[model samples]
Target: MNSDKVLDARGLACPMPIVKTKKAINELETGQVLEVHATDKGAKADLAAWSRSGGHELLESAEENDVFKFWIKKG
Candidate 1:
Protein backbone atom coordinates (compact mmCIF):
# COMPACT_ATOMS: atom_id res chain seq x y z
CA MET A 1 0.00 0.00 0.00
CA ASN A 2 1.09 3.57 -0.54
CA SER A 3 2.37 5.29 2.59
CA ASP A 4 2.85 8.88 3.56
CA LYS A 5 5.63 8.04 6.00
CA VAL A 6 7.73 5.09 7.00
CA LEU A 7 8.93 4.26 10.47
CA ASP A 8 11.79 1.85 11.09
CA ALA A 9 11.16 0.11 14.38
CA ARG A 10 13.28 -2.88 13.52
CA GLY A 11 15.29 -4.54 16.33
CA LEU A 12 13.10 -2.90 18.91
CA ALA A 13 11.39 -4.90 21.63
CA CYS A 14 7.75 -5.20 22.63
CA PRO A 15 5.95 -1.91 23.33
CA MET A 16 8.70 0.06 21.62
CA PRO A 17 7.37 -0.70 18.17
CA ILE A 18 3.85 0.12 19.25
CA VAL A 19 5.10 3.27 20.92
CA LYS A 20 6.92 4.43 17.84
CA THR A 21 4.02 3.51 15.59
CA LYS A 22 1.67 5.57 17.70
CA LYS A 23 3.95 8.57 17.43
CA ALA A 24 4.41 8.15 13.70
CA ILE A 25 0.72 7.71 12.96
CA ASN A 26 -0.05 10.77 15.04
CA GLU A 27 1.99 12.84 12.64
CA LEU A 28 -0.14 11.82 9.69
CA GLU A 29 -3.41 13.38 8.66
CA THR A 30 -6.55 11.32 8.45
CA GLY A 31 -6.49 8.78 5.62
CA GLN A 32 -2.70 8.97 5.31
CA VAL A 33 -0.80 5.74 5.73
CA LEU A 34 2.17 4.98 7.95
CA GLU A 35 4.40 2.08 7.16
CA VAL A 36 6.16 0.43 10.06
CA HIS A 37 9.05 -1.99 9.79
CA ALA A 38 9.77 -3.91 12.94
CA THR A 39 11.81 -6.92 14.00
CA ASP A 40 9.76 -7.68 17.07
CA LYS A 41 7.57 -10.73 16.62
CA GLY A 42 4.95 -9.30 18.88
CA ALA A 43 4.61 -6.22 16.74
CA LYS A 44 2.11 -7.87 14.45
CA ALA A 45 -0.49 -8.50 17.10
CA ASP A 46 0.38 -5.37 19.03
CA LEU A 47 0.09 -3.07 16.07
CA ALA A 48 -3.13 -4.68 14.89
CA ALA A 49 -4.78 -4.18 18.24
CA TRP A 50 -3.33 -0.72 18.65
CA SER A 51 -4.59 0.42 15.30
CA ARG A 52 -8.09 -0.79 16.00
CA SER A 53 -8.18 0.80 19.42
CA GLY A 54 -6.88 4.08 18.08
CA GLY A 55 -9.52 4.17 15.32
CA HIS A 56 -6.87 3.68 12.65
CA GLU A 57 -7.02 1.11 9.91
CA LEU A 58 -4.52 -1.74 9.74
CA LEU A 59 -4.42 -1.99 5.98
CA GLU A 60 -1.96 -4.86 5.65
CA SER A 61 0.82 -6.73 7.43
CA ALA A 62 3.44 -9.23 6.44
CA GLU A 63 6.76 -10.65 7.46
CA GLU A 64 9.69 -11.13 5.18
CA ASN A 65 13.33 -11.82 5.99
CA ASP A 66 12.40 -11.72 9.66
CA VAL A 67 11.09 -8.19 9.40
CA PHE A 68 7.47 -7.39 10.13
CA LYS A 69 5.86 -4.73 8.01
CA PHE A 70 2.56 -3.00 8.69
CA TRP A 71 0.58 -0.34 6.87
CA ILE A 72 -1.72 1.76 9.01
CA LYS A 73 -4.08 4.41 7.76
CA LYS A 74 -4.81 7.21 10.14
CA GLY A 75 -8.49 7.63 11.07
Candidate 2:
Protein backbone atom coordinates (compact mmCIF):
# COMPACT_ATOMS: atom_id res chain seq x y z
CA MET A 1 0.00 0.00 0.00
CA ASN A 2 3.04 2.29 -0.01
CA SER A 3 2.22 3.23 -3.59
CA ASP A 4 -1.37 4.09 -2.68
CA LYS A 5 -2.58 7.59 -1.96
CA VAL A 6 -4.14 8.29 1.42
CA LEU A 7 -6.99 10.71 1.99
CA ASP A 8 -7.71 11.58 5.59
CA ALA A 9 -11.32 12.64 5.98
CA ARG A 10 -11.56 12.21 9.72
CA GLY A 11 -13.83 14.94 11.22
CA LEU A 12 -15.57 15.52 7.89
CA ALA A 13 -19.21 14.49 7.61
CA CYS A 14 -21.62 12.82 5.23
CA PRO A 15 -21.15 13.79 1.61
CA MET A 16 -17.86 15.48 2.25
CA PRO A 17 -16.14 12.24 3.06
CA ILE A 18 -17.45 10.53 -0.02
CA VAL A 19 -16.98 13.64 -2.08
CA LYS A 20 -13.36 13.93 -1.07
CA THR A 21 -12.83 10.27 -1.82
CA LYS A 22 -14.24 10.81 -5.27
CA LYS A 23 -12.03 13.79 -5.85
CA ALA A 24 -8.95 11.91 -4.73
CA ILE A 25 -9.81 8.95 -6.91
CA ASN A 26 -10.16 11.20 -9.90
CA GLU A 27 -6.56 12.25 -9.43
CA LEU A 28 -5.37 8.65 -9.34
CA GLU A 29 -4.66 6.49 -12.33
CA THR A 30 -6.66 3.34 -12.89
CA GLY A 31 -5.43 0.39 -10.80
CA GLN A 32 -3.97 2.73 -8.22
CA VAL A 33 -5.12 2.33 -4.63
CA LEU A 34 -6.67 4.98 -2.40
CA GLU A 35 -6.75 4.81 1.36
CA VAL A 36 -9.48 6.91 2.93
CA HIS A 37 -9.87 7.60 6.63
CA ALA A 38 -13.01 9.11 8.09
CA THR A 39 -14.74 9.39 11.42
CA ASP A 40 -18.27 9.66 10.05
CA LYS A 41 -20.37 6.57 10.70
CA GLY A 42 -21.86 6.85 7.23
CA ALA A 43 -18.47 6.51 5.63
CA LYS A 44 -18.48 2.73 5.55
CA ALA A 45 -21.68 2.35 3.58
CA ASP A 46 -21.22 5.50 1.58
CA LEU A 47 -17.77 4.55 0.39
CA ALA A 48 -18.85 1.02 -0.41
CA ALA A 49 -21.79 2.24 -2.44
CA TRP A 50 -19.73 4.80 -4.24
CA SER A 51 -17.05 2.27 -5.10
CA ARG A 52 -19.64 -0.17 -6.37
CA SER A 53 -21.49 2.41 -8.42
CA GLY A 54 -18.29 3.74 -9.90
CA GLY A 55 -16.99 0.30 -10.78
CA HIS A 56 -14.04 0.64 -8.44
CA GLU A 57 -12.70 -2.04 -6.13
CA LEU A 58 -13.15 -1.94 -2.37
CA LEU A 59 -9.99 -3.64 -1.23
CA GLU A 60 -10.54 -3.43 2.50
CA SER A 61 -12.53 -1.67 5.22
CA ALA A 62 -12.06 -1.54 8.96
CA GLU A 63 -12.83 0.53 12.03
CA GLU A 64 -10.39 1.35 14.76
CA ASN A 65 -10.60 3.88 17.60
CA ASP A 66 -13.82 5.21 16.08
CA VAL A 67 -12.13 5.87 12.76
CA PHE A 68 -13.06 4.16 9.52
CA LYS A 69 -10.45 3.21 6.97
CA PHE A 70 -11.27 2.30 3.40
CA TRP A 71 -8.83 0.89 0.88
CA ILE A 72 -10.07 1.27 -2.66
CA LYS A 73 -8.53 0.45 -5.99
CA LYS A 74 -9.64 2.60 -8.87
CA GLY A 75 -11.16 0.85 -11.83
Candidate 3:
Protein backbone atom coordinates (compact mmCIF):
# COMPACT_ATOMS: atom_id res chain seq x y z
CA MET A 1 0.00 0.00 0.00
CA ASN A 2 1.09 3.55 -0.70
CA SER A 3 1.56 5.81 2.26
CA ASP A 4 2.06 9.53 2.72
CA LYS A 5 4.53 8.80 5.48
CA VAL A 6 6.37 5.76 6.82
CA LEU A 7 6.91 5.15 10.51
CA ASP A 8 9.72 2.85 11.57
CA ALA A 9 8.59 1.39 14.88
CA ARG A 10 10.67 -1.75 14.64
CA GLY A 11 12.20 -3.04 17.91
CA LEU A 12 9.70 -1.05 19.93
CA ALA A 13 7.38 -2.67 22.43
CA CYS A 14 3.66 -2.43 23.28
CA PRO A 15 2.07 0.97 23.65
CA MET A 16 5.19 2.46 22.10
CA PRO A 17 4.24 1.43 18.59
CA ILE A 18 0.67 2.58 19.14
CA VAL A 19 1.87 5.77 20.70
CA LYS A 20 4.23 6.57 17.86
CA THR A 21 1.61 5.64 15.30
CA LYS A 22 -0.82 8.01 16.96
CA LYS A 23 1.63 10.87 16.86
CA ALA A 24 2.53 10.20 13.24
CA ILE A 25 -1.03 9.82 12.03
CA ASN A 26 -1.94 13.07 13.69
CA GLU A 27 0.35 14.87 11.24
CA LEU A 28 -1.43 13.41 8.23
CA GLU A 29 -4.50 14.82 6.53
CA THR A 30 -7.70 12.89 6.12
CA GLY A 31 -7.48 10.09 3.55
CA GLN A 32 -3.72 9.97 3.67
CA VAL A 33 -2.05 6.68 4.56
CA LEU A 34 0.57 5.96 7.17
CA GLU A 35 2.68 2.83 6.78
CA VAL A 36 4.07 1.46 10.02
CA HIS A 37 6.82 -1.11 10.45
CA ALA A 38 6.91 -2.84 13.80
CA THR A 39 8.43 -5.87 15.46
CA ASP A 40 5.98 -6.15 18.31
CA LYS A 41 3.69 -9.13 17.86
CA GLY A 42 0.93 -7.52 19.91
CA ALA A 43 0.82 -4.49 17.67
CA LYS A 44 -1.33 -6.33 15.17
CA ALA A 45 -4.30 -6.39 17.53
CA ASP A 46 -3.42 -3.24 19.37
CA LEU A 47 -3.25 -1.12 16.24
CA ALA A 48 -6.42 -2.60 14.79
CA ALA A 49 -8.31 -1.64 17.91
CA TRP A 50 -6.63 1.73 18.13
CA SER A 51 -7.53 2.51 14.53
CA ARG A 52 -11.17 1.79 15.15
CA SER A 53 -11.36 3.80 18.32
CA GLY A 54 -9.21 6.62 16.99
CA GLY A 55 -11.28 6.92 13.80
CA HIS A 56 -8.50 5.84 11.44
CA GLU A 57 -8.97 3.10 8.89
CA LEU A 58 -6.63 0.14 9.05
CA LEU A 59 -6.52 -0.65 5.38
CA GLU A 60 -4.32 -3.74 5.56
CA SER A 61 -1.54 -5.50 7.45
CA ALA A 62 1.09 -8.10 6.70
CA GLU A 63 4.22 -9.67 8.06
CA GLU A 64 7.52 -10.41 6.41
CA ASN A 65 10.79 -11.53 7.96
CA ASP A 66 9.20 -11.15 11.38
CA VAL A 67 8.33 -7.54 10.81
CA PHE A 68 4.71 -6.46 10.84
CA LYS A 69 3.57 -3.82 8.43
CA PHE A 70 0.33 -1.90 8.62
CA TRP A 71 -1.25 0.66 6.35
CA ILE A 72 -3.63 3.08 7.99
CA LYS A 73 -5.66 5.82 6.41
CA LYS A 74 -6.28 8.90 8.43
CA GLY A 75 -9.91 9.66 9.22
Q: Which candidate is the best by TM-score?
A: 3
Worst 10 residues of 3 by lDDT: 1-10
lDDT of 2: 0.92
Q: Put down candidate 2 lDDT per residue, 6-29, tens digits, no spaces.
A: 999999989899989999999999
Order of the predicted models by lDDT, top scorer first:
3, 2, 1
TM-score of each: 0.97, 0.95, 0.98
lDDT of 3 by residue, 1-75 (tens): 788999999999998999999999999999999999999999999999999999999999999999999999999
For candidate 3, list the clashing residue pairs, or say none.
Answer: none
Q: Put the candidates in TM-score order, highest first.
A: 3, 1, 2
Root mean square deviation (Cα) for candidate 3: 0.5
As a whole number from 0 to 100, the lDDT of residue 3 in candidate 2 is: 39
lDDT of 3 at 59: 98
Compared with the true structure, what per-residue lDDT tens digits does model 1 show for residues 9-61?
A: 99999989998898888788999999999998888888999999999999999
Give the range of the ten consecutive residues with the poorest summed lDDT in model 2: 1-10
Give candidate 2 regions above 4 Å deviation: 1-3
